[model samples]
Target: MTLSAEYEKLEASINKSISEHNPRLDSFLFNGGTLLALAVTIAATVPWPDNVSWLPRVLAGLGAFLIGAERALNFGERWRYHRRLRDAYQSILDRFTLAVEASGVQRDELLAKITADLDQIRRSQGDIPNGTPLQG
Candidate 1:
């Protein structure tokens, strides 16, 4: 990848990481409130056995279902979006910027690292010569 592509990737990763992870607090609020409301509604409508307090179980199930659904959907969407973003960024670098010499690994290796796992990029302080998938 060229320097320009690297820059674009860096910028994009920063933007997306911010967008996805930053909303955790807000998403939590929304998810929690929604599940709580659903649980309450279920409890009100569906009466359980006389011996069982079904409301708690209902709340747990509802909360897990909602949160899991949200996470799963977000993962699917974000995965596609990031793939396109990375490809575009790399193309831009190939066309416009000078070739950036990667010191650590082959381009294919780095690209594989990037496409599969990239959490390591978060802690890198200097220019990452190779986009290797980092183990946390």
Candidate 2:
């Protein structure tokens, strides 16, 4: 295929990867934050009856669990990682698109550079957790 077509394919793949990670990041932030807030709020406020004095302790425990879970899962870290990758890919894609539009012998050189840069970016994914449905 032509270099333009190849660039389009790669761009689409990278965009898909970015899009896929977005929802996961949002869900983790929204849900985790909400639950943590509720737990802390209940634990601090609302004096419980003697019959359920243990409720505040349980909520406190839940708050601690959420913090630990955030550390263990590294949701924010993963999200930032993917975002950095997206930016890297975007820079390469932008350069490729410009090279293609310019229509010169330099297009081939830019394609090779883009390929190398993309490979490096993909390799960097290993630094983060695996199990991504798509890799660019």
Candidate 3:
């Protein structure tokens, strides 16, 4: 197969890996949230001295911090995974160049498409929508 063909196949493989990983990622986030809730509840119900009314507030703050950390880690993990996928894409593109050069295929349109696609991706990440802050 040509480099372009190989690159297309690699892209498909990256998509498949993401599909396969989604279920695991969902389960992980669900479990993490559940654990955070349970810890907060347990902290609230702790039997302490009569003057310990501030305990729940402290526990709640801790719970919020934990949740924030969990979300941050989740984002970082996803970012790393996507970086690896993009690296795979670049590798395929490199191989595609070599193959096309060997076959002397007209490459203008293909290069244009790749450049446009990457530009779209780069711009999309910067387009943030208004939303409530998840943290205080």
What value does the lDDT take at residue 90 in candidate 1?
48
- lDDT for model 3 comes to 0.57
List TM-score per model, in order: 0.26, 0.71, 0.38
- Residue range 41-118, candidate 1, lDDT tens digits: 566566677777776676667767765655645533444444444454444334322323454456556555554434
Candidate ordering by TM-score (highest first): 2, 3, 1
Models ranked on lDDT: 2, 3, 1
- Checking candidate 2 for backbone clashes, the offending pairs are none
TM-score of 2: 0.71
Candidate 3 ranges with C-alpha deviation above 4 Å: 1-38, 51-53, 61-102, 128-136
- Against the true structure, whose TM-score is highest? 2
Best by lDDT: 2
Backbone atom clashes (below 3 Å) for every candidate: 0, 0, 0
Name the better of 1 and 2 by TM-score: 2
Q: lDDT winner between 2 and 3, please give it.
A: 2
